[model samples]
Target: MANPMKIRAAVKDGVTEVKVLMSHEMETGQRKDSSGNLVPAHFITELTVVWNGKTVLDAQFGPAVSKNPYLAFKFKGGAKGDKVVVTWKDNKGDSRTDEAAIA
Candidate 1:
């Protein structure tokens, strides 16, 4: 079963710090299920964080990352009411996008 993800962020002093928690099984394809079936590998492929319409932090990940992956990073040039967006996609092409406004 896949878990639900949570995202957190804070903007202060013109800097925005963001955290993302993505819920996934992250099967490595080498694993076997209780029924002895091979679990196909499925993991995060790319992740990006955008601040005020600009890409601030970008990353690539693989199956080794871990289940319920956690990502944290910092960005610059922001203030109250600014928008910060984070998007991530899995190897299977599944994706999710979320945003937070500077407070």
Candidate 2:
């Protein structure tokens, strides 16, 4: 299992901003190890963000993304007490979900 994600959310002027930090190796399958063996592809392929049970952001990523990726975005219609959830699934079938309340 991968490490838990770190999420932060805040609302201002009726808009909510979210930031996420995910921990993963994000191997591209093309890199060679010290033993001259190719590394298998391991990366987050799907990411979803939901605000108050409504999908706000959906994304698809590839192995090209850097390890321990950082994501940030903004959306409308959120309040200080609303819940914001972030979920991600990697190519290896590993998945994690984390939530935060708007500050």
lDDT of 2: 0.92
TM-score for candidate 2, please give it: 0.97
Model 1 over residues 1-103: C-alpha lDDT tens digits? 3444577777778777878888877777888889999889998889888886789988998878888888888777778777778788888988888777777
- Which runs in model 1 stand beyond 4 Å of their true positions? 1-4
Question: Given candidate 1, what's the lDDT at residue 7?
Answer: 70
Candidate 2 lDDT over 5-35, as tens digits, reads: 8899998898889999999899999999999
For candidate 2, the per-residue lDDT at 5 reads: 87
Best by lDDT: 2
Predictions in order: lDDT: 0.80, 0.92
Q: TM-score of every model?
A: 0.86, 0.97
Candidate 1 has a TM-score of: 0.86
